[model samples]
Target chain A: MPVANMLIERRTFAKERGTDLIQSDEESPALTQEFMVANRMGIHARVAAQIVKVASRFNAEVCIAKSDVAANAKSILDVMSLFCPYGSKVFVSARGPDATEALSALAALFQTKFGEP
Target chain B: MINDRSSLTIRGIGAAPGIAIGKAFLLERGQIPVPRYRLFGEQSVAEECKRFEAAVKEAEADLETIKKSIRSEFSDHARLLEVQQMILRDPSIYDESLRYIREERTNAQLAVIKALRKAKELFSGLSNDEYAKSRIADVDAVGDRVVRILAGQSRSDLDHLREGAVIIAHDLSPADAIQLQAGRTLGIVTEIGGSFSHTSIVARSLGIPAVTGAEHAARLIAENDFIIVDGRTGVIIINPGETELEFYANRQDEIQTYLKQISRHSHLPAQTSDGHRVGAEANIEAIEEIVAAKDNGAEGIGLYRTEFFFMNRVELPDEESLYRDYHDLAELMAPSPVTIRTLDLGADKLTSWCPTLEEPNPALGLRSIRLCLHYKEIFKTQLRAMLRASAVAGNIRLMLPLISGMGEIFEARKIFREIQAELTKKRIPFDKNMPFGAMIELPSAVAMADLIAQEVDFFSIGTNDLIQYSIGIDRSNEHVAYLYEPLHPGVLRFIKQTVDAAHDAGIPVAVCGEMAGEPLYVPILLGLKINSFSMNPVALPRVKNLIRRSSMKECCRFVEKVLRMRTASEIEEAVSKMVMKKFPEEFHVFDPNWIGNTPLAAKKKSGS
Candidate 1:
């Protein structure tokens, strides 16, 4: 039931971010998954640093995309530029041997809201 | 120099009322100038980048040192400092500075400024939200640190403050405010903030004289300059002559002596002449206050404001922390009933979690029980903890604040039942028969009092918010503060109605606001038949003394007459005349001046 509601919310919000997406020019696309920013403060600087910290742990080259802006998940500044406000959605894509692990780790961060209220 | 210097007074809002004559410790944070100088050569440009990098690292180390040294109670401040450190290292500012240095050929200081400006552009581009603006401010704060470091300056540490230092600062964050040592920080004067700000709350809690909103305090008051802070009236007299010092010193002595004299008899039971009695309890947040409360003859904790456990942090306190706090408080109070009010954080206190709920008018916004119900998970976690803690001390009683109507009471009762069932199934022992109550601080609650009284175990009146909301004026507003009269006709009528409703339903009522404490208002409350008085510990003795001296017959007569009166001034005049006429010696000794709020105003902000 919760998932169904989230699905509708995702669609309603994506209608806005959909206008900003640009297709990647790579020959084959990286594995991608979408996550919602749940914390009240959204993907702020400190949360961005947590993503960079997690992303840098693996060999995967990860990027977080929101509103037409794709940021290198290893760069705090780059991740902060994406600016995922609370309740917004972001797509995480990665390419490497540990791409699956990288996506899951970022997923967990978003799930816990980087351990914030 | 002392002889030549004339006394100059700087006026600001009095956050805490007291008198402090001490030397100044100017905590001029983030006030350094950014010096712009051109790099002479490639060698100098490279050196400037290294300089900026080293300063950034040093600032990081400095913040880490402070964070490590910070006690666990200030975990919120530590988290905030950690974010600042991350901002210091972010490529948006760090790498951007290096990029600007190499590309724009600007000096490192100028490069740092440009980098920060670039970061600001990126943040503002995301959205013109308050969150983005705060992020920009964080960047600016980090930029200031690097600039100050580059210019060969050091950060002022509040932890190492000298004794008798009255801290004069731009402002202290809530965490910094909590870090102030009572003996070390004789007083606090900030350039910004009102009585409700964290600095004021902490200053009042620590019993330090504090004055905020002094615009020229930092610029005018020099380090080690002798200053007298009259926290009662928000006056700071700098370079005072002998006569001025003598007068302030005498006033200080008189206040101390009067308080000491009254507190000597504070432990006496609050039983009126005609054998009428009411519980004299104390309102407190920290567990450290159990001793003070006990010393002042507080029968039990009247209002254990649980918001302190949740405030000043990026994360909500887990069930474990909340449980431990409630359990410890329950154990300390033992057989005495401790009423724990659920989260009553208005927008101002819930800053960390309610970034999105920044209502234009927060007082009328979703708060207290409303905020709890909206954040169900948060509320549930607290309820679970409170129930678990109740298992340990059986004396814990649950109370809801700002309960506007019957719907909220029913809603909270439902939550309580769910938690109880969960506890029962889990075999977690708790006080199943624990008393539940509602705080009667709103007119709607008063109107629905008889219904609410039947539903709850008791009623506690928060007269601070009751007066504010009842009068349709913010007491914090200087223009309307005078109208914050507990004796106001409508407020008095509301109190009378609530007490009547509770008695009709065979339940007790406690008044736990400023009105519950003041001697001037004791007769009025006792006359209204309030079952208990819970207020600041210092106010307990005098309030109890007045209650002990007066009879229910006289009080009832006064109330009957005051009820017929039309204006607050008339009611106030009659009460003052009767109380003063009866207890002239006690009145003369304490001199509470009977009019202004005095030191009693320094208690923590209203929990509405």
Candidate 2:
């Protein structure tokens, strides 16, 4: 798939999942997605804070994992500890009601290179 | 380490020239202790997490305050603080510590340490790469701040340092070095750093005695220990004996008297004894330096470097901003011509928006006028701004830097005309005959000065680059730096040729380089009929004193004799002898050996 089309499909899927989350009251479903670190600086402290800020906006437990070490996405130290260099892929997952919304926001942030040139 | 109880002396590189004696104030980087403990209950874990969050909040607030205070003086350091604040609020750190407290039942302090250690390890793994490794220091700084806040320890504040105190540090970052108050801090001795480090530069500009690369400076010098820092000799004497103290006290008195004598001529005009008037101007980079230049009795602003406006900025400054800056400068130095040099960025100084291409020899690559020509819009905006500024305030001249040939001059003039025509159509009031000048920096420019002078209204010989290019020695390179001689016979010939060409073309020439500031070269430059001198503000009074005391006839005679010398050493010897004979007091303060060559010694030899 073209990268732009894949991004559009991902957004639509996230919106549908968010609607489903509103419909259900208890036992929120977990959502997971993998993304490549696109920024050349590779998610240093500043970029990590940016990701955490986006994740904190949603009422969900966002966690980022590289191999076996899973770090809370809402924590900058944890995201930075992931040591995700450029071209490296990490799995981003969220639990609770706003899981889909949180995952979608994070994926968009990564794709945009965190607004850096 | 040297014993603190006994007298000891250490040697380092003398970065600045002065002598200072004061009590040592040890400035050690604060370290935080992290102790491990277990949380027995849910309430304890929650309480520990709350404490950790509060500390992080305090650290973030502290960094914000620092950023605000430093923004005006040190913009680059303020940017670094922004990164630090982000690190402080990183969720990865907060969440990992929270998890450790909740899952492993550990205390908040221990959990925070573990999380920070993980990040540190990741950063250290990229130790071989300088960029990646530098990021580790930022991480550590943020981490250390949080830990210190938790421990209730205060940050190291160099801004409010006590007067007459000697600062002894392991190493000083540029931000910390800039924070050292000028009058309060007497001297600086660091354990690590070369003579050309940022800290040394700041110390020199502040006129403070500084010694760097002193082994164990922070460890050996205890707090409140009496220390003497001799910046000229790069010596640090601790717990000095009475005799040593007396000797340095006399030397300090001599330096003060010498400085006072030179400062007496600050308000005097630079004129030869034969009544030949010369202009002594200043080369300034920032707007704040204009007041200093005026205070130092500058006849006018000779070289206003425009690169400072482009540096440490995200985008290029627009026409209005550039115009306002130039207009303000011209108004401040009213009635005196302010020669503003267009953007001389690239070589050693690079901008983010317009990055120079990567090359092995950046010094000789596309830079200055070459780079400006490549980016026409950038060049046009600047010319338009300068013209607009000239409309608001008269006495503004445009100078082109690093022009190698007439081709660059013709191209620049074409753009200037276009801008002038557009501004003219708009009915803006500007000096239609605003003078344009070129800097003769390259050997090619010197060789073709006569041809280039015909096109420009004036010429300024930038000896710093001219000597480097002529000698094929980069002055910054330590191995070949010794070969960078300004008094070489070839360099003199170039200056003589360029000055003659500028005069022949009915235009004046000015030396706005390091050579103009040196007292030893004053007579030689005057002999070449180069009257105008532009240099650092601090050197104005002394150079003016030298020019004011000598006659043009005698200077010309001395230059004629020295030009006949074959080697730099021979020329230097003759100049030194002449200077010692004429200005014995000034020469004696700078060089003790000149004392033996005084007229007294000559009279004694005649009697013998």
Candidate 3:
């Protein structure tokens, strides 16, 4: 398999999560990943924006690396084309001032279910 | 007898009014021809290619501007634009155009049209994948638009047109309806389709009459043939012969007179002159319908469908989304009883997130409460939402659809109890006394109603499905549609039995189906001692009008008389005559509450 290391950012769930949270990953960073271009749906615009927001707060140049292609994490369009099937994982690599802390926060979000991850 | 000019009189259930005396616009299926391309010229092919690229860039700019316009008009139209953009930017469309340029040596416009036609070929065969098949419809639509634009036609997108004209299309797409100017368009009549098509929603919304599945409407009716549309009856008469013209003209006059008279009784109580009252409620699909139902004087929302929440969505709705929808519905119909059936999905309504089960016979296979029973987690999630919503509105009941026997009932009850127990543990101040009921549709359930009623709080007979299943006829099947009679002796007996069973158990029985909305069956249902009737809100006023004109005894008498009939036709004829005799002035009255008069004190004072 042509796999490349890409940073996986966590998206949180809104308040009421009963069953929706069940299918999500119980742990973060080591989550199993599937690939399909976000198709037309892209991750919900709000969810993608929130993920970008979290990455920006860490002042790190975030990038999503697929097997052959790498894209800027800040661009919703580029990340969406990566089409991470619902329960797929991508490695997170941030090389900036707040890289380690940003990676940890992203990991915790995935652990919590994207808050519902 | 043919007129000098070739003329054909088409009979359809009419949907809109007025006629235009214009040349007929014949919209043919995939008749737009592909143009030739001339890329290899005496000078240079590269220059021609550069010009084509510039034209494409220009088209792309136009597509973006249209996308923005569509977005401003509709909040969710971006979804459509996204699809359209993908098609416009698809390499296949452009590659085919380039191939035509290289092979046929065609001009830019011709090459683009040729390419789009080639792309149209991709959708020619049906795909086994449902999503793929649906996308085929989109491809055809976008292909037509692209072809039209390349042909130098103005971007007069049908969806954006707000004029009140009858739409003439080969067939309408769901996306087309979404794009339509809600306040404009009179109605749409296609030469194709049956019930549940997208055009039906458009016609219903514009409140104009529509006739679909009309094989060749485009060829037959010359533009604007002084059309008289009666959407309720699904009858369309164009350039009627002498008798026909007179009949419709008189019918129109009579309808206007009836409207005037019904206005007088609009504010009247839904009680007969002799004082037996009937509660006519509304069956709503969305929270928006709640307001329309209330405005139509619905006593309550008898059937609030929950399936819509799950439709057209990618993921399962979390408890919050469910709670918000249910709570909003409850809040809208607050104090009035709102009966919400848990996700009544069958194999036909497959969700990607849920397990897919293939069944040879889906109608008889696992669905409704049965599916919920096997999939407790799905059912439990919905029940939890309902319980939480029940706190917002005091009188919300959880209904189970397609329950056949005691087994399904007990299973649902067990799940209900489990949810209640969980709620109690959480101290969620929910109404434990709220009624729990089963829709008496399956013949097995009707046969065992008395036994089933012993455990349930209420019975809501889903007559549409009940009649179909009981008669062993699929009403959806056009060939057997005539056989799907609601008043068949077998169907009547089943309804009577179920109603009597519920009444004897001191529980109320209501009907929520197309049958409840029909004026012809109102008395028959009343005679069966049904306490409530629920239908589309538009039908509520007319049903109420029928109730006001009828006493329970009189309805019982009519029912008794009709029961003796041997055939469906005989029953229908007898009921029609009776309705004409008893309600001549208001036969199929539209908008009984349109006049907005409160029921007279004398009428309300009379006792049941």
Candidate 4:
């Protein structure tokens, strides 16, 4: 239900086709924050799904970074490939309308340990 | 046509029960071979790219449709399906496949395969994290669906599958399991899976006979090859000879007949259209029949006859063996209620164990509870085992059979409590709240129903014995057999009273004897407000369908009409009239002579 109340500030999204989506290098200041994975499962399939649900809620381009380079937070396959484990740090960066809101949602999710025991 | 094929049998796990002999419909899924072909023209390359895009779309649509049909349990896996849908749209596989198609001019199947390989390598990142394997499996699952689509052998193709064709698959996923139509899909044979796999569980739930882990089943059997899937023995015989085919065909007929020819609807819930749910449970003696019971959609084990253990053995079965049997039954039925009927043995059944303990009239002699109470040590051992199982399973219910008085109730309760205290002293676990109850079959028990209701948590009427004792006639006796009437006015009154007494005391009453399973008696029993019924598992589907079509309001009204009747034959005629009006087709299946003067052999003991 946490994702049910999500409000998008703008309707600006990528093109009709996702494969043709070229990441726009925004000159606007981007909001970035780092949080440690607290849940024992870390970023599992269910957790990755939670991240996607939160990230896709905004007009902003969400990017997640783990032990390696950042991957598209909107794409589940991309977010999962980041390989964030328990106690590992993940960096979330977004640029566009409501960038701060997206970052805040990600922060809340990480803080709650993705609702795992 | 069948002579040219190989005569072979594949051994696998019997994940379900019953028999099916039919043409094989090969559903070659989960890892299709990638076909590589070069395109000479740009037009051809573009066409191939369009094919890839369309397949991804189709696969996405398939996931969405499955998500919608996920039913009452939608939320648990709806998000997972969305995640899979996203994988279909992911840039890693989608863009890479498009790239391969445009630049390399490869076929859509080949392009999708190469792209999937690349995506898998990318998903396993820098860290050797343990989460990588399971995460990668998701990618593989999504990849497999796309590949199956590209190969034109997807699960959607199964929608057009001919009725009663046995499905042969490389493997079946939980997603595929969801789309399976129990009535249409006759049986299942998978090349790769275990007895406890999701596919097997689904097949069992649907009451479809399935054999899993049948290696090379798809390779060995071609489409339209006549085959037999024996789910009981886990044997898959491909393209049998004429003699063998005829034998298996007869075997298949026998199974359907055993189930009264309604096996297709066996998996359906016994819920009325008005949303009232009834428990369609099973009564089994042997452990192997538990599989058949579950496959037939038994909600729980209503009466587990434990006396079988003591019947055939020369001596008593040790406490350890009894504990394991009860424990396994409990664990198998986990959250479902399993009512274990304690040691219902008469002098008639103990001929193998104690030859000298025979009574001239065993039915009226010291049997069942009387025998158990007389031999207190043996009874205590069985109680201890059941209590131990109750602790582990958390769903065991103890029932004392043939209890005719409060004196016997107090004695049994005292023994049960003493064992609980002994277990508590030893620091052993058992469900202290485990319900203890009695069988409402004897005339004396029926007379004092309201008073007896206070001492017990529940009541299950054994209609067979209730009729036997109440009418003073033995069903086995040739001359007096005509008096064994289920809907006899007196018997109906007894059932009504027991149900009313239990309801007044806030306890549930169940019917587990022959009267419970008879299709003609469903509406009548439901009218009496007895919602829990335990019968032979084979009769479940037929009886459940009747329960589903009936409403509590209508059943109450019907019971009102029947209460005014004075004879069993009159009630039988009324029930026949109702069934002919409500379900005209099934009216033929019910022997209208059930309560009339034409006596049949004493209940066919095959079911129990």
Candidate 5:
């Protein structure tokens, strides 16, 4: 079963260069893509765990790939293994019964930057 | 055997006690390579993973014991152990170990190192805020734990530096120092640090005489040769001859005796032998220093510089918060006088509270009272706080900084009256008769002291800035720092003028500068008709000892001789020698090179 593509905000990449490691992309299919960002705070264990947990809650089968390694969207361990910093983004793809709902949720999460205020 | 000939003897500030002579062990970051994991076989890997997990648990237990041992010494630092615990329990490290053993067939140590390195990289990339920065230490702890787990050693056996051994490191993590047995450790010699570095502060707190900033300190000292470290003077002596060792032994005894003497007289007054009473006060920024001040026998807090609270945080503290801080401090120093100086900010003392201005020379630019006056709301809030605080336990005196003329004094007094009127209208329970004074730190202030004295209750000469302002030299500028002469004829003249002016108006004058508290300048300050001295708490005993040993008449004579000197160098050389000759032990130069950084300047450096 393939999920419908969800419209997402235009994502701007950070100027700083780093690795692209995806932790989650189940919510927003259009926005669930990896990026090379040099964000001040790298993708950390807590951030990775949060993204994985959020993605796991959705019905869409979210798949995140970083570098050459792709892992299930639910594994915190797999997400942290990517070693992405501020400007790195990972490739995200989700296809399932609730793909549109998953994509929309995921896009909102990326836009808000993993809930960091 | 533990006292291997290859062990090094290094000179450092001896903070703690006992002897540790051990083999040379260098804790260098370069030795540890970045670790990587690989896959080998699955069936055998499952068995190895179990062994690795068991080893990690043993190591974790050992770390807990070490944490408990230091729990008392570093009560506030127990949080460090919690971070270490999290690192040890990190799933990334455990999972990586399993993966490596199954796939790469690497040893447990290699796997652990690889896992920890990955974690370190993750934390290192985080933001600079405390939440992220704290995890960096966790990474280092993880590395330490991995080594311990692989070695199959308990934490007790980990700190196995030999007796009287000097451990050299590129830079020691605070955690490493904590794990070392305090009583057995000789000294820490690091290649990194300035005077106030974290390592230095920790060394001071631990009392583990240490000497840092030595270029290749580890490489320079070899196997067990005798060493001498003068932490007070920053002098290091290596492999001293018999006579040199004897000299140092005797010097150490003298220092011990001196410390004992100070401890005995800690509670006594700072009155000179000739019956002239000199009020010795402490300069404090944080309220925590108030405890130290009391312990060190301070009669009062002379300079409660409040700028530290406003620096780098908020634009301005609301009046309620200001009132609470001021009043709380006043209560703490109840019955004892606590002189609260208003928010003294300059371009150099830039804070988020004030907008940064373009001042070619911040030292001479709009600063101190000038900056406050320009910002009426800021100045009034502070003034109101002081007035509110005056009603509390202590006798509160308002001190204005950088007053250049009678007009400035008048303006300051006018503002004070306005605040008092507001408090009166509000019917706030505040003291109406709080004494107000001005700091005579500028040349113009000294020039118009007589006129300004009539409007103020007293005058406190801030000698550090007076020297800089009078000579038009920046004391902080290292190239021109040598020009920061406190005894310059012009500086002395200004100090004398201000002191005399206050005396003429029947008001007392006290030196609240580093000069007033120096052992060498104690006599001169007393002789110049200065009635009181205020300095950092650590300096109280030395200043008090000097005051107790000297006569005001002799001090005046010394001041007379010094005032007659033509040049700044001549005044400095003559005063230092005269005092050393008269009271060699008590009056030696506190810090020969640090002559320019006086008590007030020290506080200024911290706040500004």
Candidate 6:
């Protein structure tokens, strides 16, 4: 098969998987979670760095969205630019080969408050 | 922009001093290129990803090298590089670009460009916020580095800049400012910066001509344009005519001549014309500044802030470590008494080991001696170290910072006596009669100066905090900074009362604030009988020259005249006139237009 045709097929599969994950009736490849930004300084430089460090380890496309603004979780600048002040709820979504692993790691990081008060 | 090349002159804050006439070297703000291209197939997509990875690696390596080189000398800048490195390693940038290549059929460079633009857009929405704006600069810096690597461009090395080039830039980071070669760089004109910016501070230290807050200097002054930077008057004349060049040339020569005259008295005693003596001292933070203090003819070290030992350490400094540092300083400054102020940590500065209390207003909360008194063991450890150091070098005096009333001084005195007794019991040969002093910084201290003076040997007026507290203005707050006038009537009265009370109690008073160094305030302080003036090392020579030229009798009369003034402006007008009249040569060096003031020129209007 041509690469473009294969990409189209994969996109369709990913879309169907995303829908299934939202329905919660079938096994899905994607993981979605919400967390409060517990760190007093929120997603500042150091905390954003930590989030990116964890998200990059897995073969997952992670997206962290605060309000209507979403950023690539692996990009420190993107995560920091979200401007998720302390106590704001951050929505995390992962879709790829290792979406579950990426989601769990990120959730753990948020729970630890990025090792800050 | 002022495009009239022949006679255009711009004004800005004179951040640093010295004259420079040189060709302009306009630094273009580094704008990263965002190249977008569609990938042909899977092979092309993989190739683009590889290119992106290589660029990221190269950028990371470059930042690491820069960080390592500046680690020792410029640690703060090195730390900034650490954050940038983290940004480069961020997987989101890599993943986002990889996804773009796989799904969108775009090249790696385009993907990275798209990701950064998303970040930039987020920051742009927060343009009104200063914190967010600074963060935007950081984001741009990271993006620029990556883009430069992808474009196969090397970092712009300011180190090898051509000699005698005036640096014109939109803004310079602290790292860039530090990298500026003092000899090669003739002058600096920035589009956006302040007098207190890191760039300005570095320029001042290097004694280079600098003018910051020049709104569009980089755009107005083209590369290689003939420009004359007048640092004294904060003026920049571009493509000067022959007549203007000649005028500046003569003015530059005059300033140099005046500076040479001031340095000639570096080794002279600080005495008035009528032979009344006053001690000129230096306020130092580290031992390295001791030589500068001595070279500037400081009679003694009036304020040796001991917080240096406590900062940047994992644990509280041990007695041995503190003792060695203090002993060396005391011994080097021999016979010249070193007034070592106890640990003044808190308010703005805090230690990791110390218990952190959340204070809404840290400035008014537990700080300085208050923090020390609460943490008695820390205070005792420091006192033990100072006393031990003084044992070997007997010219050490203890000065307490942020004292509110007589009770704190009394408690401190009690602890001092106890420490002396403990040392004596252990057969330690420390100076038992080491003079103790209180910093009259708070209104309470000034109000109860007589009682406080009776307990301590001398008084050192910390006019920086005193003025801030009296005027109800935080000096750091730019909005209220204008109200932080040291010449205000209430402030002067507080100072006068403190000086008189100290004198009445048979003790001397010294001023170790920004006001003490200002030549404009010297005569008034002299009239108030301030026994000593402790200031920055650079201001010493000029201040000493002023003191030596003016008589005590004349200073008293000037002070009396100033004290009777109603407003701050009136007092300032009267003092500026008095300074020009008494020391016209020195006044010209400080401000050439001082004599042009109508109030100063009209001598017959109010003949005192």
Residue range B1-608, candidate 6, lDDT tens digits: 22243566776766777787888887654654667778897888888888888888887887776666552445545666776887666544556566777899887767877766655655676523544766666766677767767777543435436467988888887546865666778899988877656677667656688988888888789988999886645678888767557756766677779878887897799999999999899987777667668877889999998886676444566666677788888899998999999988883465466767888988898899998888888889889988998876689989999999978988888888898889999998888788899999999999999999889999999999999988889966869876878889889999999999998999999999989987878898999899999987667888999999999999998888888989887887788888878888777666554432222212221232
When summed lDDT is taken over every stretch of 10 residues in candidate 5 chain B, the lowest stretch is B14-23
lDDT of 3 by residue, B1-608 (tens): 22223223444543332222212223344565556545556454566566666656655665566556552424444555555555554545665566666666777567766666555443343222333344555555656665665555533456435345555566767656655553445455677766445566445443445667766677666555544344554444455445444544565566556645564554456786688777788887767556557756788888988887676555666676678778878887878889898788885675566667778888888788777787788788899989898998687988899998999888788878988998999898888887899899999999899999999999999998998898898866769876888878788888889988998999989899788987767878888888889987766667788888787888898888877778777777777777777876665333222121111111222321
DockQ score of candidate 4?
A: 0.21
Q: List model 2 lDDT by residue over B1-608, tens digit each.
A: 22234777787777766788888887766455667888888788789889988988887887676566552545545666776676666544666677788999887777877777766655554323433445666676667677766777653446435466989999886546755666778899998887656687667666788999999988889988999897766788889767567767777778778878788778888999899888899888766667668767889988998987776544566776677788889888888989999888774455455655677898898789998898888889999888888875578989999989999999999999988999899987778888999999999999899999999999998999999999999977979886788888889989999998999999999999888977778899999889599987767887898899989999889888878889887887887888888988777765554322222212322343
Candidate 1's residue-wise lDDT over B391-490, tens digit each?
8769999999999999998998998899999999999998988999999999899999999999999999999999998899997788978788888999
TM-score of chain A of each: 0.75, 0.74, 0.55, 0.76, 0.63, 0.74
Clashes of each: 0, 10, 35, 0, 48, 2
Q: For residues B198-242, write the lDDT of model 5, one tens digit per residue.
A: 565555544455667766776776545455555543444555545
TM-score of chain B of each: 0.73, 0.74, 0.73, 0.58, 0.74, 0.69
- Model 2 score (lDDT): 0.76
| Candidate 2 similarity to native, TM-score | 0.65
Worst 10 residues of 1 chain B by lDDT: B599-608
i-RMS, every candidate?
5.6, 8.1, 8.9, 8.9, 9.0, 8.7
**Which structure is stronger by TM-score: 1 or 3?**
3
Model 2 regions lying over 4 Å from their true place: A1-117, B1-17, B21-30, B36-156, B168-178, B189-205, B210-251, B312-314, B347-358, B593-608
Q: Write the per-residue lDDT of candidate 4 for residues B9-83, one digit (tens) a residue.
A: 667777776677888988754446678899889889888888888999998887777677654433545667777
Cα-based lDDT at residue A97, candidate 1: 75
- For this target, which candidate reaches the highest TM-score against the unseen true structure? 3
- In the order shown, the candidates' DockQ scores are 0.21, 0.19, 0.07, 0.21, 0.05, 0.17
| Higher-ranked by DockQ: 1 or 5 | 1
| Lowest lDDT 10-residue stretch of candidate 6 chain A | A16-25
